[model samples]
Target chain A: MSRPIYDRVALIGLGLIASSMAHAMKKWGLAGSVAGHARTAETRAAALEIGFCDEVFETAAEAVKGADLVVLAVPVGAMRAVAEEIGPHLKPGATVTDVGSVKQAVVAAVAPHVPEGVHFVPGHPLAGTEHSGPHSGFATLFQNRWCLLVPANADPEAVARLRALWEGMGSYVDEMDAAHHDLVLAVTSHTPHLIAYTMVGVADHLSRVTESEVIKYSAAGFRDFTRIAASDPTMWRDVFLTNKEATLDILGRFTEELFVLQRAIRMGDGQHLHDYFTRTRAIRRGIIEAGQDTAAPDFGRTKSAGD
Target chain B: MSRPIYDRVALIGLGLIASSMAHAMKKWGLAGSVAGHARTAETRAAALEIGFCDEVFETAAEAVKGADLVVLAVPVGAMRAVAEEIGPHLKPGATVTDVGSVKQAVVAAVAPHVPEGVHFVPGHPLAGTEHSGPHSGFATLFQNRWCLLVPANADPEAVARLRALWEGMGSYVDEMDAAHHDLVLAVTSHTPHLIAYTMVGVADHLSRVTESEVIKYSAAGFRDFTRIAASDPTMWRDVFLTNKEATLDILGRFTEELFVLQRAIRMGDGQHLHDYFTRTRAIRRGIIEAGQDTAAPDFGRTKSAGD
Candidate 1:
């Protein structure tokens, strides 16, 4: 077994990411003790039953009482409240971190609640799925995934220590400014989610009021957006609310580009459409080469089966 | 073994769909003989090597000679030329069908070329993946998929025989007016492709002139769009050109909805965003119930792993 990074680690939210963290810690023996808590007593019991944590607490305050490292794993909107609730109970000199999608708001909200002696290093593991809950995590979720670390100060030693913890759990850690991280994610993730949500909404309205044929004939392509649109409502709502400005900025850019294409379609400009579609194929090749995702055919089909 | 639907079937284009149809026919004994042709000698050779046709021909004219059923399986833009090439060679009273995404244009293009004694049916199978070419097809490709048929006052007996052929290959066939089929697919398939193309184009452009960093951090969600953007360029180019009006209408509606969300995001209207996202989730649930797609957790884990 590898050496443990921390004597005791506390997870303030036992959702998908936090549970995955617990599983990874256990798989790698990276933490001497892993304790966690959820917002409700039922989830705490569920987390305990799933063996996601060595110990489960009903409240965030109780969970962090003796943890050497505390991770805030709740939604961005709840980060400040959870941090404030647990701050007084945290062991002195503990490293406080997070797995929220938006790092800027998380740092601004959670940093203020950190005690003087605590190391408040804000981090966002760039791994997740549409599902949420204490039981929805896996040890390999963060395997080969990127984790952005946004430490308020340029303390190399402190950042390195935290990076080691993530590395031990099978993630590659990169350091960047919190604001830039949010903006990067706005273009890559938030804007895409918003677009997916809107398209699904259009299909739903089309299916219900316009015609029932939409769902009957959905396998053609409308089904993919539906899968993305089915993501947890509360979590996404918090995301848009917290990452408003960055999302808006990206959305504006997307709208401008979409308008140009829309006009081309309106004017029967097949060449414009063909040129745009052809251009996009190159980026997909780039993404495959970069290894951000699988290049295989989608829907979990093997290359042979997909063919 | 199941009975053959036609004594001899001729496929005018030996691409992915035609190859898949051949495999399906062979697996189900739906055709006594499958003859196929491609414009290029290489594709015909590839079709023979892949065992996609019982007899490979050098031209559409040669392929359709004496066949009971002739299927035009080329790109929509090539339908008219293919029909004209095979018109004189087709057997008297034979059933002719073309598998194209857009029905109205296909009917208008191919109808005039069909002889008086022939029955012409336009069809679109609601099934496919990112793969193309004669070698990328399988026997099960049409299983449990929808096949839309638009028969313009063609022989009812011929339509029944064709429906039986598709049904024997494990497809569910639905008949609709040619114009209606074009409009429905425009909203469901054509518009979605255009939107996905535009989104991928935006990301591709951003990745090119700006930075490769747009890809390195793609786990944020851009990876999904990349997959959609990787589809066959020529096929998608034809779809936009053939289904212009319906695609434009849906694109217009999509723009209006997108503008509202964009404005809401710009104004920081959290309630509006939240409500929209929530409504979209229900549609995803409906799609899951319809069994058109998997309801598996977007993440690779279940609720037992965590939220």
Candidate 2:
């Protein structure tokens, strides 16, 4: 096995991402000892019971003590508080990073708390399932996925070391500016999630369409939207709140495009609708070719009991 | 072995649905012989080469001759023409059914041409992958899936026989009015597909975010939309055109709900966004409980080559 990248790694939140990191670090020997902390006692207890972490601390500050790397894996809204609590406890030369969905706001909220000698890098891993919580994580969660780092004037060596840690956990790492990360994520993740939530909500609110009807007939396509809509409420809420500008901008574009398609449908312009659909099909092909998604039918989803 | 449901069955479009039906029928011995027809010679050749059909005919009219069951599996826009051509050739005491996404338009287009003593049942099978064509089918595609029959004044015996055939093919069958089926499907299928296409188009058209970036980071929720958006453009275009009112109605409600959530995000109303997201989560659980979809994360999608 390869030598551990960090002597001691502290995970400041024992949620899906952090727990997955713990498992991957253990699997690959990426870190010598993994310590964890969560705001809720239930989560801390659960993380300890899961046995992914070597030690579980009650406070963020206690978790970061003497650690070479500290990961703030809380909701983006909670990052500032966790960063402040752990700021004084972090080792002088340690690097502090986060696994938040939005980079710009996370940087704004947590960067100010880092001490002069400590390196602060904000990262957003472009991987997750709709399921959340510590138990929902697995060692292979980051395998073949991208983990983006926003160096933001941090020391190059610190950034390189952090990239190595993620790469050791089976991720391909890339570096980009914080603002660009936010805008790209808004287009790729945030806006899509919000649109899915809205569509599901519309189905819920329709009087003519019973909830049972929606559930029974969901195999027709709506079930895909529901999968993303089933994501953690608090985490997604913070994502939208913190990444407000870019998400709103994307949403604006989405609504504009939707209206044009709507008009084509209303006007009986099959050619226009067909042309638009054909163009979008090429993008799906691009994603499949780029190895971001499987090309299998229905994502090669296993049959449920109903099937 | 039990007797076959129909002595001769003709499938009038060798796409995913019809090809799957051919395989399922052959697997279960549900039909004595299956005759197939496609608009394109390439599809007809492929269907014959795949060996799912016992015989391939050049015209829908020729395929329906002497057959007790004739299935119109063409795109909704092509249904009327196929029905006109096959009407005179359909055998007496035969059943003519269609496997179209929209019911009301299909009923209007095909019902007028039904000959005396022939039964016309319109069905919408709530099962498919993002794939199409003759070879993109499997014997178990309909297993545990719903096949809704819009039996509009059809003979009771014909409806019962069709129901038995679907059940033999491993589908759970239900009966409903054409209008109700259209509205239900608009909520569950058509509107969701249009929304997915629109969102993907927005991403494709955005000048600032490169296509490569979107494809690389797609695992963060955007990939789900791409799967549905990648469905057959001609079929989807026909669906939107034929089921315009209900789809537009659902889309309108979608935009309205989206605006409310957008306002909540803009106003920093975390409570509203959180509550909305929480409510939508229940719908996903309901879908899982109903056996409409698998509960596994990311639809239990297999890792692509990148993984």
Candidate 3:
């Protein structure tokens, strides 16, 4: 194995992303020691039981003490509180980064609490499964995934160091502005999740009052939405609450476009549907070519909990 | 190898589904002779070049002559025409079936044209890739998938023989009524495809207006929609047209439910979102328990064409 990238690494949240990072660190031997803390005692216990961290602490301050690198992996809405809690305990010359999906709010919330001489770099790894919690993590979760590093300033050395850490975990890191990151993720991640949740929620209600036939034949397309809808409830609630403006803006645009399709369907306009299907097919092909995600079925090699 | 299930098998409207069946038949030695016919002569030549069938015929009637089993694998909308074309040529005791998504319509369309002694068994195998055409087929495609049979009458011998045929191709067969089959598929398959098409269409238009940024940062969630959206355009168009009433009914319900979620998002209702997310999660668990699908990522085992 290569030399440790960091002397000590502290993770502030123990959900899917943070837990997966711990798995990656262990798999790659990237950190000297990995310590973690969660907001609740139960979660801290779960993290300990799952062996996600070398040391599990009850408080964020306890987790950050003497650490050379600190990662904030909580929901975007909780970044400010986590920053304030750990700020005093952070070692001087330590690097601070986050795995929040929305970057701008996270930076705005957590930046003020960074102590002098401690480098604060916000990062978002575009990798996760719909399943959450410490138990839902795997070592290969970040393999070939994209990690966007939104550093507060254009500091070449600090950025390179953070990039090295992620690269060790099998991620390709690219620098981007926090505002643009939020806007881009709003369209890519936020709006998509909202749409998925909305569609599944709608189908559920319809299934309840009607023939329940909606889900019986769910293999059509509603099955996909269910996977998205099944994502961590609290985390998604926080995502929408934090990424409000960008999400709402994109949602408005999506609504206008959906209305056009709905009208076409109502009018039996096959050309419109055909054109839309063809265009969408091209986008999927682009994604497959980009290597951002796999074109294979998500659960093909999945082993169950018992397995 | 096992003995051929039929001495001769005829495939009408040779496309993705029919071509795949031909491949499966050849690999499994399930048919001594396989003949294919499409509406277009070019398709017949292409089928011949790819060797998807042992023989390619110019007319459906000619293709079915002397065949003990005939499969109508055309677009659901074209079933009636194909049924009429091949009905007179069907062998005296031949078993006839279809691979249409909508069963009730196929029953109504084909039942009228079938000869007195021919067994008209409407079937839909829940197996496919997004790829289409004679060239886009593999013998192993139907391994461990479902094939639903909606026989017009409770003829146990005919059903048993058809079940054995699907089993030979590695499918688990379930028998049900034609109308119920259509309704179940509407919820599982049809509604989902419509929404995916609509969402992709929405994203495509959004990308055009936003100048391509929407696609540049497509996250995991939107990426899923793109895959579903990318499904064959003409095949989907035919599906919607043939199953208009069932699709329209489900679409109407889906819209109403979507409105509820939209209202919740606009009002910033976290509780509403949370509860909906929880409910949808249970449905996914149910689907897994029923073995309708795996919890793993879509087709995670098979490498993509690019790979």
Candidate 4:
């Protein structure tokens, strides 16, 4: 679809993000050749089966050799080990990047392992689905989605080259500091995910003993939370563990807010609850106005899907 | 779609549920004629503007004058007043129903006002969007959604007639006792909504003074919570206040579960979080398989509208 930005792009982890990037790059012809590797042979086989990559390797070191770009798409907790395994094999002057959710930790885990000539640019694509694994990747996952690039002290040419590649793949690129990105994501993604996991976990525990028929007759609202809770647990567990400070800070604020609302519910303070709900509605409107969210009714329904 | 089930149907309080019922009734020709009433003249005019009813009345008393079926669709808090205002004017042997979320409270509030001959069958249709007011209703709002009927010793024929009307409108009708309905809704809808509202409120607070840009970078997960949080504040406030006992019970469980998760995150217990999240995924899978949710990668996207 366009000129190739990198001669050979290698993905060191062939999971959802890696597979998606491979698909999008191949779809747009942004890379001369895309190669993939996974810790498991089954995933490598799956990647080859999906035909998103030109070749699939069994080892991370094998995958990164001679590639102009190497994507560390593994879990955040696995970043250090994966970087150590693939660092020496990276192509000279290669621009190394990652698609991990947490940035500051990823940078700390990865930067020291990179060779001096190679570039290390960390990014967090603010996009995903409830589904995961190699088969779950889709080419349009990054379209219109925000991809925050945290290129800490990297060569400007290398950062721009990475930005251009992301832009070519249909992502809206933004640059932000790692700490600020972590804090923003704590409020926007991490804390909310923890809360959703908590609620769904509560419902699931109730389903085991209680007679609310929580799953059998869950309404649209609870069902939405279930979808979020159903996301990959390993990734989320790693996320919470790695992004500890920011998530804990947001969670503390959330607990304080929850206690206040809980007291209001207990005291029958309708006005307080009404005021809070009304205030939150404006942020939802802001998200829609900013085109960050779809204005469609979007609760697994037909009429509101296209609106 | 079927023979007219009611000679005349009157909808009280022209909000989302009432306007939607009017549209659905008109869509299926389930009623010979439809009339609507709202305390606000603007709502009455808006109901008339929607062209779903044959007439729009200014008073609840005048609206149910000769109707064979009268739907009390006001907020749960106002059910008693509306019931009392219209009780004396209802046609003898008419079916009086409500689309309130809380069942026991509604029955306690409205049953005493119903005339001896009139059937008081309280109900809750588990179908709605974050939008509200007259303009937010749609003909397919109830399509394939569950409408729980809490007839509670109401005449069998009256309940059957109401079920038939809902069926004609494309909803799956189910019957449950009032207490059970409240408990089920507390677990499935009420607590989920309250948690979403709290999370969004937390996000809003952070966005004001914190340099996080929380709203601007809300990922797919948090955006879903914003939609739920953006629901009509008045309706939700009433839902919590009216369904106090059950909602409180669920909230207690949610807080307990949240504390455990917070502790786990603090202690870096990835296994605990993983097991909890993995267990919750089964409930989501069950919801999807039971046709209550969609498996179509619903991240505010274009797929899964009809699945």
DockQ of each: 0.52, 0.80, 0.42, 0.60
Model 2: DockQ vs. true structure: 0.80
Worst 10 residues of 2 chain B by lDDT: B298-307
Best TM-score among the predictions, by candidate number:
2
lDDT of 3 by residue, A1-307 (tens): 8898897999999988999888889888888899999888888888888887889988899999999889998877788998998889889889899988888788889989998989998998887777788887777676666788998673678788889988887776777788887777777778778777766665566543342445444555666777777788877877777777888787777767766766676777889877877878887778766775565543232323221
Point to the candidate with the largest lDDT: 2
The parts of candidate 3 lying over 4 Å away from their true place are A40-52, A207-219, A294-307, B1-3, B39-52, B154-156, B207-216, B296-307
Model 4 - which docking category? Answer: medium
What does candidate 3's lDDT look like per residue over B33-129, in tens digits?
9998887878889888888778888888999999988999988778899888888888988989999888877888999999898888889987676
Output the lDDT of residue B63, model 1. 90
lDDT of 3 at B28: 82
TM-scores of the models, in the order given: 0.93, 0.99, 0.90, 0.96
Candidate 1: which stretches are off by over 4 Å? A152-154, A207-212, A302-307, B207-211, B299-307
True contacts kept of 3: 0.49
lDDT of 2 by residue, A174-235 (tens): 99999999999999999999999999999999998799889988999999999999999999
**Tens-digit lDDT track for model 1 on A165-272?**
999877878888888888888877888888888777676666423435777787787777766677777778788888888888777777788888778766777788
TM-score of chain A of each: 0.94, 0.98, 0.93, 0.95
Candidate 4 lDDT by residue in tens digits, B180-221? 888888888999999999988877777432523665677657
Q: Which candidate leads in DockQ?
A: 2
Each candidate's interface RMSD (Å, one decimal) is 3.8, 1.4, 3.9, 3.1
Q: Go through the candidates in order and give the clash count of each.
A: 16, 1, 16, 0
**Backbone clash tally (model 3):** 16
